[model samples]
Target: MAAAKGAGTKKPGRARRKNRPSPRERLLASATSLFTTEGIRVIGIDRILREADVAKASLYSLFGSKDALVIAYLEALDQCWRNDWQERVAELADPEEKILAFFSKAIEDEPEKDFRGSHFQNAASEYPRPETDSERGIIAAALTHRQWMHETMTALLTEKNGYPSESLASQLLIFLDGGLAGAKLTHDIAPLLTARDLAKQLLGAPPADYAI
Candidate 1:
């Protein structure tokens, strides 16, 4: 009997598994697409559920509410942005090269069409309440990214170029941020190139012979 039961248990080919998307994954995918195209506030729970082809109970079970889902979506976006930049910046061993790689990555990452400005900036602009966890998380991530850029620039300036001034890094950061803002506002690549030029000038480093 035990042998028979074991044989019956092993009778199937491969065990078939359901390929359906989990409730959370479906909701997140829906929110990501909607939020990327439409502004975050404009998208509501009903629309997300309908678009995801999920029931309200599933969404509520996954995210608790629309606001929570929005926060999760932004967090996911942050991770993706950071990962892309990190990969681009990783190719060059030199810190200066890496610094320039930052701007290069920015220009490269620009959308082909319907490119709106920074998602974090846009989201924060809509939600200014610092008390909210979502707003606070976005603000914190933005600051962290800026700090990473500044620190990377500082390391390059100090280690590669031997610049002694502590303030130089912060100044470079300001210039780079301005360049990025200009690029977004003007929708022109010139500002990014200008920023690269200015970065070389600020670091007292020579222009790179090759494009990043």
Candidate 2:
């Protein structure tokens, strides 16, 4: 039988369309990609919507507002790090070993997209003042991550390791930020490797040879 006129016709050269991701997944995937690839400050909400292929109404309904959505993204980012690196470091019996392991993970090559530096640090640099944005999501996210780092470092260094937690924690964070920046600029992990060695030295451990 001949195909009827106006019937659906399949062509060999036609491409199949992928099933659309759920609206929430689409939004997260799009926001993360754009924010990481370009920057949070530079990427606008409308652009995010377009990339997500979701309507403004959907985005608002899902997140309450743009700020809320960004906060969600930040939360996701934080949880990812905690699960990926911090949890594993907890397995070490020595608190000092835990501290070194923290920095060691940073230098180790994880299966991930090209290095663009820490997302929290990048957001902080882009939006240092809360006044810069009306909702202040960016500033809040940055502070949240920093507080976590402070708490973790303080616990390991002071409670178990018998070091001055306050000063050392601050110094370690400074080194972390510096190493992240240096790695992004140089496209080499040596800065982070060096930072780990410096951290060991600060803890009174003999500095190990750091490699690229």
Candidate 3:
């Protein structure tokens, strides 16, 4: 009957519980938390496996190696960060809002999130070797994040104030990168606020008051 048929119709694929994440997701999730909270270099494969509740074989089979895992984490973070910023600012149609939203969220969210600042920056510092593929991947990921900022500023500046994207984008990139670095060093969000306010003025918006 219908009830019997329904009871027999168990969905396929590993029979995971409602709340449980898959092995791959578990590995990535565990690494993300650890790498974000603690720098990536100090953490090892055994710890990541233990935290993820997965086996070493699973880690090897799923991610190949520690370096790959780290690279995956950074690349994922970069894509997600950019997408999240876009979604956060989707409601505000102003190009300037799209531009400033990056700094505003960094100012507001970073502190509440323990304010480690840029994952790319952290990865670059952690993996300094240019020879290895995974290490080079770290550098590439960091550059990709910067490239996104550059292209974003370029488009916004072109649309809003009729300025050349190449020139203004470079300036904006400096403020953003420097602001993040200084904010991390000082444990203060004031530099980001200053950057945002300065950007507002440059973009022809009303100047914001930035007081720490």
Candidate 4:
């Protein structure tokens, strides 16, 4: 009887360990999904803990507070977006094609419901008063991501076709921004397709080459 009881307890313990997410990872994943779907302010620490299935003590131990979790979440999102784009771009041979690929992938991944705007933009709006270091860090990270897209597109335009790199880059960025905003506001993919058509015109290419 004693041996059976010990084995049962050990099994449950092992199962619990397997089921639990690491505190830091749990908080980050929870915050990312919540903040991306809902406004950051609307989702509080309690909700994060519940969604993460982590203890309040564990969250505090890992992140210290809600603000820290939010910063970490944004940082994680930044890394993820960068890595995904790099992977997608790597699949294409031409630099200009890669630029179009980036936009194409963005539209393909449009959310089905509760579609909030860009995570960076939403976070910036929520934490307008950046009195803390954490908020500043998130803002810097978000800006870096945006700047990277522009710089990358500019370099590709200059290197691939010798276009007016600065002007072309600005135009492309505006098109992309407009597409994302329109997609969220209108809940339609037509805007994305329109953006792709405009991009092809800007690049002087056939629709097949730049189809998103």
Candidate 5:
């Protein structure tokens, strides 16, 4: 009772792949975590690769260089912050309140410990006076975020809202950045609170106490 030769042979089993993020995603996530916690200029590609558990060749293939990866990380961060801002201001009825919500949300979201301030501002500070394409790209991404906030605030504070000055919106944007920088320096959200109060005064709205 001999079995058939071909029938008795067993087929080789295929390897099962784990459910994990793609190399690009892992690299971005690693870069974002390191860049925000540590300065972008200080964190190198090797660190990012080690954190991401990805290969050097994969990184080079996907991003072309460390600069490209930084740009991708900044772009991703910009989108995330924009989405958070939109969600924060979505439910408010007053355009002015929506603008104010940005400040309030910042206060609420900040943990007061290891706070790193705005990613765009950090990137801008690191890449000031860009000379190369990558440097310019980095700065452009940062400025894009700032420009968006300025435009959004301008629309919110336009003539329909009884405030017609785009300069005021620009001022508010500066205040937000200033407050964030102060918070980073002081390791407290008190500066942001001050910024919010000043913004209220500027908008001629009654000041509400914000406790962090």
Candidate 6:
């Protein structure tokens, strides 16, 4: 009777296996995970393929080459981050709250276990002076995201919040860059907290009392 009952039950594992991600999806997932945690240059295609359990042909067919894969990874990262930030601030009515929420999300959303600084920043540093087309693509992918963030913040501060100049937005960008570096160096969230407080002061928002 036990054997009969077991035979009648559907296998959850089989259902999950049937719904597994495609080869391209698997390759990107592996590349993003390894590249973010390890690095863009340090991790090779073999390692990504091994981790992804995918074939070389699939990678080439999907991404063309390793450099292309890196570009795709950065592009995906950029999209996910911007989408998440927009979603994070969507419901908030206050423009200042929306601005401050960016910093808050950085602190609250990201896990510290294997935290690395911004993937874009890391990739840009890894290829300091881009020479090849692929290198340029990689750097462009990184800078484009930063540029979008800068423009968005500037518009919010100057146009929406009645800030006199765009300089405040630039300063806030610097603060965020410095804070990310500090947090990456120290493996702590203190720097992010400090950055948020500083941003609040700049925005003339109510002061937060955080000791870091």
Best model per TM-score: 6
Please list the residue runs of candidate 1 whose C-alpha ends up more than 4 Å from where it truly belongs after superposition. 1-17, 131-134, 155-158, 161-166, 205-212
Better of 3 and 5 by lDDT: 5
In model 5, the Cα lDDT at residue 111 comes to 64
Clashing residue pairs in all predictions, respectively, total: 0, 0, 0, 0, 0, 0
Candidate 3 pairs with clashing backbones? none
Cα lDDT of candidate 1 equals 0.71
lDDT of 1 by residue, 7-94 (tens): 8784234453255677788888999889877888888889999989999998888877787787788778777867877887767777
Q: Each candidate's TM vs. the true structure? A: 0.73, 0.78, 0.84, 0.82, 0.84, 0.85
lDDT of 4 by residue, 42-147 (tens): 8888899898888999988887888778777777777888888888877678877888986787688766443454677767767677887877876776677678
Query: Model 4, which residues run further than 4 Å from truth?
Result: 1-10, 205-212
Residue 192, model 1: lDDT of: 70
Rank order (by lDDT, best first): 6, 5, 3, 4, 2, 1
- Local error of candidate 2 at 165, Å? 1.7
Preferred candidate (TM-score higher): 4 or 5: 5
Clashing pairs in 4: none
Candidate 3 residue-wise lDDT, 1-212, digit = tens:
99999898867553556558888899999999999989888999899989999999999898899888987887888888888898888798888788888888788877875767787888888766678877787788778888988898888767765545566667777787777887888889988888887777666642231111
Between prediction 5 and prediction 6, the one with superior TM-score is: 6
Q: Candidate 6: lDDT of 16?
A: 88
Q: Give one digit per residue, the lDDT tens place, for model 6 in 1-212.
A: 99999999989999887899989899999998898888888998899999999999999999999999999998898899889888998898777787787787778754553558777899999998889998999999899988888888888876555544456678888888877888888878899889988987877842231101
Candidate 1, residue 160: the lDDT equals 67
TM-score of 1: 0.73
**C-alpha lDDT of candidate 6 relative to the true structure:** 0.83
**Minimal lDDT window, size 10, model 2:** 203-212
lDDT (C-alpha, whole model) for all candidates: 0.71, 0.75, 0.81, 0.77, 0.82, 0.83
Off by over 4 Å in 5: 1-16, 159-164, 205-212
